[model samples]
Target: MNVPAPAHLLSLATASPSHSMRQDEVLEAATQLFDGRFPQFERMAPVFKHAGVLTRQLAMPVEWYLQPRTWPERSAVYDEVALDLFCEAARRALDEAGLTGAEIDVIVTVSSTGLSTPSLQARAIARMGFRPDAAGIPVFGLGCAGGATGLGLAARLATAQPGCRVLLVCVELCSVAFRMEDFSKVDIISTAIFGDGAAACVLSTGADGFAAVAGYAEHTWPDTLDIMGWRVRPDGLAVVLARALPPFVRKEIRLAMERMLASQGLTVEDVDRFICHPGGMKVIEAIEGAFGLGQGALDRERDVLADHGNMSSPTVLFALDRIRQAGLPRRSVVTAMGPGFTTSTVTLAA
Candidate 1:
């Protein structure tokens, strides 16, 4: 059987905010803010150490999150920082692909941390210099799976259009959602593992590129809406993380991978490497376990987690960038899980 060629990945690039916070520094700050306020502060504080994050980029200084912030203030910061990060990442990707923003035929913007009336792509159209005719698609609520899902959608669009180019940009300013008043365990863990970052990639039907998108598939588990999502609040979005996440990954991810691969008549052994969303230390470990991979098999995932924390939708793209930099393997699988309890997977061929 012969397989048709899929969209080529022309370029990928990632950008982080200027301000950064070390894990220990954030731990101390969190302690100062949560102690005496939340009764379980001391017990939940250990999540900072166990999260496997050494440092993470922030849209603002660490002290900024310590203060009370209203929805308007947080939204303002999200608007400014998300735009800057998106433009920076998109510029780098376009430059690397040797193409201008005006050449893009389609733009897919993925985000979940904050709300924007015009959407990020719509707001940055003029700033990015994209053509007036280019189609803009803004995807939200996918959370961590947005990067892979957005890339898959972009590839599909480029494949359908043949000569057209598609740009996929994912930006998340998870830091802006920090809530001091709601000192739940989910909030504590989220504070320990969330950061601000952006990533962009170019895809086209042209053959000149590092890798081709072989296939893309997704699966949304039934009745799992509460597994992970945002709780709308007057102040800002509150993190809703269930403790069953790691165990869920361990039990369900491999089966999801199998089904996705089967759709293309491929299997786990056919993939030379796996680049996945590094949601956290436990999530990575669970993924490794599911795939029967040895411990620490996902070094790039760990490296990104240590350097940038979980930038929600952009984290998988950061791992993808690292994989490409290290020289892409002949066959690779990119996967990420998000709020829909959805698992998005993309198969790549070098």
Candidate 2:
């Protein structure tokens, strides 16, 4: 028989600023960037300003990243930024789990927006003072599903070893990829949305962790690669988020949920709490509409979205941390969407 891990979520460390940017500031800046290329966006000033985003936090000050020569610097800014987030989050997760570096048998780090050799997990193990021989699972290109996928992999590790302990950290430096020159609809949409942040959790074989991840499912939509991805150009990495995503979620989410639940011998009715990734207002709205959930089903999601925007892989974990803190009834389900037009779901019991 497989033994389940006593995995609990740790305190989340966000990279956004505490002070909210004023609507005027956002519009004035956006207008300056898009005045000629996307003149139509000027009409969206009011809508964009109030579009469910009241405030957000960034890992670094805006000017430090938005400077003219920042992107061209050959200093490998991506790895450093990713390292900062990973180290902070690993510290918090280890503290929360009440375990030191030597106790962890495995380290799984996930990211889609950054690249690093010796990867985040290795650097984290070294900097965070974990044992040198701790196995490292560095997952890249998992996109938004990276967090839950990390959990899924960690759970398997816990199940494999009778007393194994695993740490999963998700870090995204999305702010580093902002496009001021390309003012297309996709650019504007991604700019107004994606934010930088990190979230981490610890899984253990003993029932001493925060909560237990009971089951999970992963699926991808083929032929939909173009729905969302990054394109490499001489200028830099460009984002592509299709307008069809909102409609796709509205139409296919229910079917996906049904399959996800059935795979674990569950149904939506059996789930007491729902922790969903707040991809955006449209994605949340699509989820609510498809699931027929009450208004409150998304209250926490709306709160996170208003506060942090979307931090990619860490987004769903952010919501799950809220659910864990709120002390909601047990038997919850956490779900998220990602590139590959994929969906990931994990069932947990508090």
Candidate 3:
């Protein structure tokens, strides 16, 4: 059987909003907001300090999250901030690829934190100036798995078109979901780790590039819709982070990962490197457990979590970008778990 040619990744890049907050800063802000309001906040306050995060990037300043925000206001902020990060990341990726927006034939944007009508691709036209006939694909609700899934989708598109340049952008303003009205453990935890950022990559069937897309696969668990996602509220979106998540990852992720790898006709032994979304410190630990790696084995994953917190969908790409910068191994597997209780997996090679 003749194997198909692999799509090549020309370049990868990441971006973050300007408002950087230290973990102590976030902790103090959370204390000010939740100290007297929520009875259990004081007891749960340590979650912020122990989140394995040193700093995070937010589109808005910390004080903005202290006040109540209506859905309309949040939606507007999402549009402005998300588009800015998208353009920045996309430009860097294009530049690193030694190409331009006019050279891009397809654009795939993925996000779940907020909605954008006419999509970010259309909104980015004034800044990017792409060809009029360029394809635009805006995917929503993939949540944290979006980066890996977008990479896979762009690679497949590149494979199909052969010479067409495909740009994949994953942008998420996860900080917008911060809700002051709600004070549950889930709310507190979300405040402790969630941040805003974007990641982008340029791909095509080009012989000269950093890495080639080896394969892609994913598996969504059954009856697991509530595992992790956003819950719409009167004011804005809220987090639906189940307390069972870490345990679930430890219990089930390995078998599912094995199954997905099998779909690509590979095994754990075949992968030389692993890139996973840094959902939080605990989730990173859980991912380590699932893969049978030692603590701190996935240092890039930990570094992204510490520096940027969890930017959801773009997070895995942040980690992948770090790996690419440090230097890639012979083979690598990038994956993330999100709303589908899904594991989006993509393989890359030098």
- Using lDDT as the measure, which candidate wins? 1
Q: What's the residue-level lDDT of 321 in candidate 3?
A: 85
* Local accuracy of candidate 1 as per-residue lDDT tens digits, 1-350: 95445799999999999998899999999889999999998878889999999999999998788789999999999889999999999999999999998999999999999899888888898898989899998888999999889889989999888878999999999999999895788888998999999999999987568899999999999999999999999898998899999999999989889998999999998999999999999999999999999899999999999999999999999999998898999999999999988999999999
Clashes of each: 0, 7, 0
Please, what are the lDDT tens digits per residue for candidate 2 over residues 1-350?
94444444433333332334543455566677777768778665565664566666565565654554334541265677678878877787777667777887888888878667878777666678888888888888877777777777777777777677778888887766776665578776766766778887777666554567788898888898988877864556677789999899999988888898999899988988778888888888889888899655688888888777778888888877776678856798888888898888878876
Off by over 4 Å in 1: 1-5
Model 1 TM-score relative to the real fold = 0.98
RMSD of each: 1.4, 2.4, 1.0
* Candidate 3 weakest lDDT stretch, 10 residues: 174-183
Residues 75-103, model 3: lDDT tens digits? 99999999999999999999999999999
TM-score per candidate, in order? 0.98, 0.91, 0.98
Clash count, candidate 1: 0
Error of 1 at 275 (Å): 0.7
- Residue 199, model 3: lDDT of 92
